[model samples]
Target: MPIEQGSSGNNNVGIGNSNPNAMLTVGGGAPLFLNQGASSTTPFLAVLNSAYPTDARYGWAFYDNSTNGNLDIFRRNGTSQGIQFMSFNRNTGDVAIGESSPLFLNHGSSNSTPFLAVLNSVNPTDAKYGWAFYDNSTNGNLDIFRRNGTSQGIKLMSFNRNTGDVAIGESTPLYLNHGASNSTPFLAVLNSVNPTDAKYGWAFYDNPINGNLDIFRRNGTSQGIQLMSFDRNSGDVSIGTSNSNGNKLAVRGTIGCEEIVVKSASTWNWPDYVFSKDYKLKSLQEVKEYVEENHHLPEIPSAQEIEKKGFMLAEMNMNLLKKIEELTLYMIDQEKKTEQLKSIILKQNEIILNQSKRLEKLENKL
Candidate 1:
């Protein structure tokens, strides 16, 4: 609660500029605190100025020396001799809030050393507990930081250099280039899963005929490859030229599991899962559940009895043919729509031509 201002031979009771002779000015105006120690130094303000804990055990202070540059903020620990938090480079221009170093800079064990280094940008040291984003102005990129178990993390997606892209690993990483969206693109993606374990995840970039996107993994290395391609005319599945390279190859042999069937273009947004909305069984569990819940159970059949109960091979073949017919019908419907649109356009063109001719005859008669 008590404040002191020192000037030369006398000390002022309340806030005011220190007299030219005072060694220190504790309160506001001009040199907030002018220290006239034989080595007379401009006074600095300590926000938590009390001898013991002020409001709480932690305390902070701010100093303003306009003659040098601008106002500055500083914080201190009860036992420490220097300010633990402050604004201003002791070696550079005067410390000013919103002037030079506007935010609180915590001085670690080293004197005047900044705990966090921000270059040409507004930086949040820590956000959402451990998330931090650095908006670098000089290079024009955003650097996002997240505290992992023993390290800092970042998103390594592609970005635009002209607009500013972020590097995945380092805080001060350079924003190099743009991505598919004509912005900064990422060169790589780092996985969080264990590196050695086959079950752990992996990531890589696939830059085929079109653009680049990261491919992630869960089980096998052979399956990690991604094909960045699409059929332009039919909008069917087609891998890009980059994907055509044997490098993007997936094991073509009969596999243990069924290959994922992409039903529609919009399905890319969701993780690939077995079956679509009309969920038939995706796994054995689903199959059992459906049989138990939907069908009336007769007594458990013996091996010989089961053979008689099961569908005949001919019946299975017919069901398979029916599915093929359904798919064929769907394709034919799409083709029909295409033909219909073309016919409508042609008819409109003929009508326009006939109308033009009629108008020409009327003009001649007039």
Candidate 2:
């Protein structure tokens, strides 16, 4: 080995070439190598050491004695020495960015702040242009933030792994919003086509004026033909504006089903009051007179009224039952009167027969 040292003030040392600008330089095709003895406490490479006892010191390529001789970066502050900023598992090749103990690749851990923060660092005033990931200790959720030059970044999204629910643009998202704007917050699903489809498969539109959420399905190119709508303010549902013309579960086409059942609870007011004794039953004569005057049964809606306003089936059925009950009462009264009349005729006939027999006996004597 040949060594050439420069003059006392020049402070230059060259191994193969002379006139070196650096303090130490090696020339030729040979490579510079450093060999260190196997020690868990010593570093293989060190850049700069602290001159004073109070200054903070940094080093690279240090062997960690705590992690079973794992290679790591060391940062020292005063008498305290540790791998405070970063650590690496040489065997596993797992790098921890801001954690002393990394469980996985790119693992970040902190106590009072975000576990991971990616900063732009291009401009200090607008330096909040990045992302942050942290656990929300307040709500016990995983929150992801998007920085917009604010002190605390805006929470753009969250996820609850336990419930398997992901929230976007809101802390607690019941549903997802595609167009998350203040003016128009809606979602649209488009159909796939060769030349690009103009038809929407489905769309959810938010109506701020009515406070309704309108869901639309595309029949053709007509967008926002409402299939259904939910009113948040009044809790009303509108359906089939897109398929049919009416509201509240309207359908254009015919529906085929095995059975359609409508259950009316007992709390519903039924028309059993018509059968009560206090119910006023009109006489047959009065009913006939009324029918002749009005050309319709009493308490029944006329054809003209039915045409004007649709009839309710339940109400009409009750009215018809009342009329039937009235007819039954009339029949019972008429039957009793007929039986009494028949009895009187039979008694008169018997009396006439007896008088005839007595007259015949007098004629025979003469």
Candidate 3:
């Protein structure tokens, strides 16, 4: 009987073991059996550090909480009992991390670090390939990272807690506030080759300073070159140009559109009002005098004014219509005068014919 228990198992026992410290220690790559007949539901196994925790929290433990019937596999983390990091509810058959009461499968709730990580193949070549998601307690942000994907180091997406901002490829996004002030960006995507180079990226944000929605893209290292912008204050739009010049739309380049619609005022505002009886249709003489003095038609903008302020297309159309209506009225007056002159010419012809007949009768009497 080489197996011996020293006086009712009071002293330490060893099987192929050299340490005399452990009460029951198994060595030589063999399994250590605690008990063969104990209830499996009874939690008893624990692996701990050298010093015992006076608080009775095991450093490495497999135990049932007894309160919620949850079996927890715990490991030490920064001097705290991290049981919920890997816990399974015996009652609900739920596996969770950092969740006190898990209801579904693999439900994880965490604040500072990621609850789960799915790394690339366990091979050595995949060292820098992985994805992680976590809620950052420091900035109250939710961030997702791809180890080495888009442009450079590992920032895929981030959501800010305070500003409702979503940023991709940029950590600290800069935006413009309603008053054209520089606020943090709402959503940005930048993949430029260098930090100082804005040559290859684009951003969408609300400019705090300009109070407009701006779409900015980098082209050959240019910064803040807006591809398009919509003014929040004036409802103006600009393309290839940042300044709308108070116009509804301003384009720095040529535009080719299938159709463009510019709405005018109501029907009553059309130039048909010029034909109304109450309308003062200036005489042709008056118009001639005005054109001679001003070198332009009356009630029409001058060429200098058009060049300076730019004319409205719809307004100009209405003004041209008014001039055409005035011309038509002048033609009507001229036609009436021509009819009167024709009547006078016919009566003169009748008088000449009658006088010639009287002379003929006198000659017959002679």
Candidate 4:
């Protein structure tokens, strides 16, 4: 190959070309290459070997992509192969590690030819920092971790791109807001299969029209079924339904519980106060009149009110107790009246007996 030097004073070199604009130019449909011999432990194009002795030990080396089609970026460790910082498959344009094809290629689960990894066979246990994405060949799961001056790498999340499922590790997502700024704040995740698949997935989003946060499950491309809803206006929550109209919590179906405690009972005035000395007891006639007029007990909520506003658990319990205590008082008063009537009847019977005895003595005298 005849080499020609540039006419300019810069002394630019050109191969197979008359003119050269750069330091060196090679033309004539040929490639510039370094044939460092087969299995040679040497740097083909070394740069400042004495200055960067450590980096130069396993750096600036290239291989012909013929045998396994792996082009390793670095050659580290005392071994000739060295730790592969990154490797690329020239034919498929896929990234891999350990000079081997990714396990996902044979498993046929991941996205098409999506493989990017970092592997160190020598120090396999040592964690790599600064944006190291690893895909476990054995587990067949992709993991992302971050090590910011910490002893252990925090596995941020694991994701299966094909399934579009992401599992969070120890770290959790947080929202920070101190004052009312009228900022519409929310977090949502959506996952779905291909459009043709009948079995669908789930989604969480805000319903602007209804003022609710909705979590729904989709099935067979139909309108999603709401699994849970949180009312933004009233702070009410509903399960198996969209709107919790009146109550703080509403369930479309029955709720089964082993034990239920009315935790807010302290806010209610218990009905034991009905027995206080200052309390006035209504007569039975007055109660009868009130019942006839209102068709419900006094101090008790009507059916309409309960239907619209929803009954308070603690307050209703206390009201029922008050009615029970009132009934007890009525019973006690009736028992006293019956006792007086019985005494009067007994006295009358004794007087009649004395009168009969006196009449008998008078007849004997006659």
Show model 1 residue runs off by greater than 4 Å: 1-34, 38-43, 46-83, 93-165, 170-187, 190-235, 238-252, 258-316, 319-366
- CA lDDT scores, all candidates in order: 0.39, 0.54, 0.57, 0.54
TM-score of each candidate?
0.31, 0.39, 0.48, 0.52
Work out candidate 3's RMSD over C-alphas: 12.9
Q: What is the lDDT of residue 291 in candidate 1?
A: 61
Q: Summarize candidate 3's per-residue lDDT along 263-333 as a digit string, tens digits.
A: 65565378787778899888888889999999999989999999898787788887888888888888898
Candidate 2: give the clashing pairs.
Answer: none
Order the numbered candidates by TM-score, best leading: 4, 3, 2, 1
| Off by more than 4 A, model 4 | 1-96, 100-112, 115-201, 219-221, 245-247, 263-268, 304-310, 355-366
Expressed as tens digits, the lDDT of each residue in 186-229 for candidate 1 is 33232321222233233333334454453444344423544333
Off by over 4 Å in 2: 1-185, 188-200, 208-211, 241-278, 311-314, 337-366
Question: What lDDT tens digits, residue by residue, belong to model 4 across residues 1-366?
Answer: 878777886575666656643345455333222333322233332221122212334333444435565554554454454554454556655554443322112222132112332333212223433333556564555765554333236655665545544544433322111221212223322232222223345545567778787766656444356788889888899999987877688898889999998665456677788789898999999999999999899989898998897677777888889999999988988999999999999999999999999999999999
Q: Can you tell me which runs of candidate 3 are displaced by over 4 Å? A: 1-116, 120-130, 133-155, 158-186, 193-196, 204-214, 229-256, 259-268, 334-366
